[model samples]
Target: MIGRWIFIRGQAMGRRGWLALAALFIVALIVLMPLRMILGLTMPETITARSVEGSVWGGRIGDLNAGPLPLGTVDAGLEPLPLLIGRPQFAIARDGFSATIAPSRIIHANGSVQIPDGLGGLPVTSVGLGDFSAAMADGQCTEAQGTLSLTLAALGPLLPDAITVSGQARCEKGALVVPMRGPQGMERLTLKIGGDGRWQADLTLAGLPQETVEALKSSGFDTRPGGIGIGTSGTF
Candidate 1:
C-alpha cells in the first residue's frame, strides 16, 4: 500500500509540472505575437507611415512621417519588458542613424531631409536634424540637446550663394527653440515649435550691404534695431 501511494503522488507532481510549463508557453505566445496585428489600432494623429511588417521583436516602419518631416524607411524593434508595463519603447534605425522612441522622450542622430513646403514660408529647401534629443515630463520640456540647420533658396540676387543657417536647439516656455545664424552672423532665424504642431519663425538680417538691406525692406521686412526683421507663424 505504501509503494502505491508514493507512485501516485509522484505522478501527480509530474502532472503539475507539465501544467506549469504549458501556462508559460501560452503567455509567451501572447506576448510575442506579430506587431502587424496592432500597427494601426492606436496610431497617433501626428505620425503616419506607408506600412509596417514583422514581429514585435523586430519590424520595419516604411516611409514614416512626423508632422511635415519625412523619416525614411526604418527598422524597428520593441523592448518587450516595457510593453508588459504599458509603456512600450521602440528602437528605430535607418541607414547609419539610430534612435529610441518612448512615451515621453525621443533621441535621434543627424539626418538631412527635404521639406516640400519649406518652413513657415521662409523658402527653406531642406532641413537637417543634427543630433537632436528631447524629453518631456508632465507636458513640460525637461531636457533638450542638439542642433538643426535649414537651407534656403530663391532669394534672387540678394543671396547668390546657398544660404544655410544652423543653431543649437533648446527648450523655452515649454517649446523647442532653435536660434540659427547665417555665415558671418549676418542673419538670424529663431524658430519655435510647440507640442501641438504650431510653429513660428522670426528672421532678422543685419550687417548686410546697404542694397541688400534695402531689398529686404522693400520685401516687407520691418526695420529693427540692427536690421530688417520678419515674423511668420503657422502649423507645422
Candidate 2:
C-alpha cells in the first residue's frame, strides 16, 4: 500500500514539473517575439542636419515598442526596441533652397550600417550624410546656422581626402552671394572635382588663361612641369 502511494505522488509531481516547463517556455517566447520585431527594422524616411560649425539639430522618432505599453515606460510589461537606426534622408530642395552657381546634379550617395543604442543604454551611432554634385555652382550662398556639418569618418574613405562645402546658395539681385568672409587675404582658387573622383584644373605656365595662370603663379602653384599636379589633401 505504501509503495502504491509513493508511485502516485511521484507521477503527480512529474506532471506538475512538465507543466511548469511549458509555462516558462511560453513566457520566453512572448518576451522574445517583441524584441525581434524592434531591432534593426527599416524606418520611415527622416531628415537631420548640422551646421558647418558642428552643431547637431534634427528630429527623428526613437525606438518603437510592440507590446501594449505606454511609450517610454520601463515597467515589467514594457519592451523598448528600436524601430529604425540612422539619420533620416532629406531632400535638398525641401530642407532649404539653393541656386547653384554652376550647373550640377548629384549622382549617388550611401552610408554604412547604423546601430542604435542597445539595452545597456549606450549612445546610438552617429548620423552619416553623403552626396555628390557635378559642376557645383559658384554663387551667392545662404544657409541656416546649423545646416551643413559632417564628420570626416562618416563621409567614407574617398571623401575624407576631398573638400566638402555645405551651405545655402542663392542668387540675389542678379548677383551671387555667399555667407563667407570677404575674399581678402585668403588664397582663392576654383577647383573642378569630377564625379569620377578626378581632380583637374588649369595647370599651365604659359598656355593658360592669363588671369587664371597668373593667379596660380601668385599662389605658388607654378611649378616646372606645365601640367597640374593632382594630389589629395587631408581636409573635408
List ranges where model 2 is wrong by over 4 Å. 1-88, 94-206, 209-215, 227-232
Residue-by-residue lDDT tens digits, candidate 1, 1-236: 99999889767787778788899999788667676555554335566788888886788999877677777788988777767888777778887456766655667756777777777657888888778887766656777889888888756587687778899989999988889999789879998877666789888878778888788778778888988888889985
In TM-score terms, candidate 1 sits at 0.79
| Predicted structure with the largest TM-score when compared to the true one | 1
Which parts of model 1 are misplaced by more than 4 Å?
Answer: 1-32, 36-43, 80-86
Give each model's clash number: 0, 11
Give the least accurate 10-residue stretch of model 2, judged by summed lDDT.
47-56
The number of the candidate with the highest lDDT is 1
lDDT of each: 0.78, 0.28
